[model samples]
Target: MVRLMRALREERRWIAAAGLLFLISAVLGYFNARSLDETLRAAGVWERLERAVSVIRADPTFLKAFTLIYWNNVKAVLTMMGLGIFLGVFPLMALVSNGTMLGVVLAKTAQKTGANPLWLLMTTILPHGILELPAAIVGAAYGMRLGMMAAWGVWGLVTGGHREVVRHWRRLLERIPIVVVGILLFLLAAAAVESILITIVAK
Candidate 1:
């Protein structure tokens, strides 16, 4: 945990930039969701979301929900981290897409249930989002770092600096495990908090 915090402090700029982009995308998605009649053609999205919410609300076993949600979050974080090596493409897309989905869900739910979107978000996402969102951005940032490192290596090889590039690559590989471990720990904490909060709130 100390190592993770140190790494986050070191890469604060990258994570902050990703978080800003996510917030912007979320705002756009919120506006897009507001005009559901014109913007969304598929009614299935609303139906599926409603069904999922209903299932969560009606389920008796909080442990089951907690486990499922925790696993899902773990998978998402791992996938994002693994995919970040592809020139950071997947990480960027994942962050933006996730933010957009969040906005859409919050807005749609509020509109349907006659609740305030801000209140719904506060009750549901804020608890876990405090950790999860930053952890996600940190994971993506590390992934982007890896992607950038690879790109630099490719460029170096093309420019006849192969030995130097190889050295740098070795260093990056050594550091990656630390970042991965930190992200996993963060996600675990986030999932636990989210599951507990959601279960309590739902009940």
Candidate 2:
């Protein structure tokens, strides 16, 4: 954990870049959410999200709900990282899609509350979102890094044959700890806040 934190701290620039990417994605999503159905369709996770929502509504215990939410987020964060080897395309899309979902939800919430969108954002998302968004950005950043490694690995294979590719693979493996540990810790905090603190406040 200490090593993971240190490594993430060292990559402050990358994290900031990732944060900027996240905000850009959110802005894009907000605009796209003007056509909510289209944006949701593009996201392609509405069915799974529906099921998750059902579970959240049905589950009586906070632990069970938290577990469900945590694992789903874990899968998402991992997908962002794993698919990043596709040269970061998937991670960027995921960010945009998620941001779109947030926009749609916040829009609906604002409508229901008869409040401004920014007020709805502040009341509903700002708390856990602070932790969750950075966690996601870290996942995307690492995925983008992995994609770069893969690109370099391919370049190495073409130019230097196997040796350079092997070196790139080794570097990629060494960096996995920072991505995994950082995402896990941040998401855990986000989940706890969303399920416990936010829920309590909402009531």
Candidate 3:
């Protein structure tokens, strides 16, 4: 835990960058909610999301929902981290996409239910998002870091500084276990709250 914190501290800039991008994109999404909704629907993404939600809602015991939610989150975070190696494009895109999705969901929900946006956020998202969002940010942050390293590596190779590139790669690889562990812990807690507590509260 201590090591993870230290590693995260060391990469704070990347985290901040990822968070800022997400916030900005979310604002954009909220403002353009209608158009975005249309676009997502056209792409079939909205329908898929609805289907997934319906499946989860139909599960009586909540265990299926918990497993689904947890694994989905785990896969998403891991993919973001793993694909960040390609100049961090995947992580950056994921942040913007996810942030926009959140905004769109909030806007649409408010419009459909006539509920205050703040109330919706508190009741629906905050219960789990407090931890889930941070976990996602951490994953993206590390991904951005990896992307930076990859960029540096290209420069290093061009400049014949292979040794330095290798050293940095080694260090970054060493931190992966710590990062995964921290992310998993957060996701587990978040999933439990989302599947059980939030589900009950909503009912």
For each candidate, the alpha-carbon lDDT, in order, equals: 0.75, 0.76, 0.89
Query: Compared with the true structure, what per-residue lDDT tens digits does model 3 show for residues 152-186?
Result: 99999999999989998998898888989999999
Which numbered prediction scores highest in lDDT against the true structure?
3
Q: lDDT tens digits, residues 51-89, model 1?
A: 756666778366766676667677877788788778888
Better of 1 and 3 by lDDT: 3
| TM accuracy, model 1 | 0.80
TM-score of each: 0.80, 0.83, 0.93
Model 2 lDDT tens row, 67-175: 8778988999898889999987898778767776787777666667889888778876887688888788888878877787788878877887778678757765876
Candidate 3 accuracy as TM-score: 0.93
* Model number with the top TM-score: 3
Worst 10 residues of 1 by lDDT: 36-45
Residue-level error in angstroms, candidate 2, position 60: 2.9
List clashing residue pairs in candidate 1.
none
